[model samples]
Target: MSREFLPGQVIVYPYLWAWQHERGETEGRKTRSTSVVVAVRGANDGLTHLALLAITTQPPEPDRIALEVSDIECRRAGLSDFKRCWIVVDEYNYDVAERSWYIEPDEPALGRFSKAFMMRIAAAFGQASRKSGRRVNRTE
Candidate 1:
């Protein structure tokens, strides 16, 4: 079944980070709240391509690109439990939602980010991508 996805939506996912993939790991060690940055349905492939950003509680290092999540934004994204969080923009997990082995379509989205906030994220992602950001292909 095809699942509807929207940018800024928050969902639970086993997000494989680039570092883990570099170490030959194919799966994330645990499921966490992730932000859906891009979701596009391919006309020819009839598959939904997703670019998901990891929502991490760990503070970003000096060299990494990240956006700090405010308390209000966290609540809006269903992340009130976390003391703090940031959306890592330097890397993302790419997946084909229709053919995904990990995405659970039956599960409802945790919450969603406002369109305004999403615009900021999209812009940051664009910059990050241009700077040679990493991508972990979960569909592979």
Candidate 2:
């Protein structure tokens, strides 16, 4: 059975898109590549968080992958704080049919995976959205 998730909740799915950049070159050669989504964060603040697994051919193994989260993504995922907040995937479109992919799944394993994925995405979102020096007031 499928699961249900509320808005501002995180969701993680396999990455199905990739491309290349032609702006800069490394070591006098341009490199093209693709990436995958290992995790995603749901945003209560009005955005979605995505953590990408970047693959490259360098000193590290060609199969080696790195995980990275972008600031723009965090902003898009509506991340504001780092604790106790839920991460929701952004699947709302005014023109397209509204599909609910965040619902609670009947499968316990799937549910756990989804929740774990959301948590990871939330962590990434928090990292990207966290203020450098300012601390949030806890008493307020």
Candidate 3:
């Protein structure tokens, strides 16, 4: 089974192990959480990029962690627009203070993809903003 995703469509990945908090968790237990898809890109093998929003028992922080997901894995997880979902890290731990919140698509990130893919994602975001009537500031 295959799925098609559009650019700028917000997808959610719930229970995704965003990170681990050593001081908060008990013993060696790791903390887990979910994330939201912020953008999608590429054609040959589209990459699903997400913005892992911060979560908290109380009020979460205003910042968000970003990640690039594989289309194959996303399909396997049945991820879709507006659908809450979760992913397990299985290896790395999440540390908010360190600002490390990304995991490799398969194993490594050495030869991820060309810079063009990033540009495509950016363009997609721009198109979405325009379609939604959101003003794009000319100045940086």
Q: Top lDDT: which candidate number?
A: 1
| Candidate 3 residue 135 C-alpha distance from true site, Å | 26
Candidate 3 TM-score, C-alpha based:
0.23
Candidate 1 lDDT by residue in tens digits, 1-140: 65689999999999998999999999999999999999998999988999999999999999999999989899899999999999999999999988889899799889999898999999999999999699999988
lDDT of 2 at 139: 14
Q: lDDT (CA) for every model shown? A: 0.93, 0.28, 0.29
Across 97-118, the per-residue lDDT of candidate 3 in tens digits comes to: 1122333223211112223443
> Candidate 1 — which residues are off by over 4 angstroms?
none
Pull out the clashing pairs in model 3.
13-85, 14-85, 14-86, 15-86, 16-33, 16-87, 19-94, 20-94
Structural RMSD, model 2: 15.4
Q: Give the alpha carbon lDDT tens digit for every residue of 27-119 in model 2.
A: 212221212123233355332332322222233323322233244433334332322222222111111001323212342211122344445
Candidate 1 C-alpha error for residue 17, in Å: 0.8
Q: After superposition, how far is residue 119 of candidate 1 from its true place, in Å?
A: 0.6
Candidate 2 local lDDT, residue 127: 53
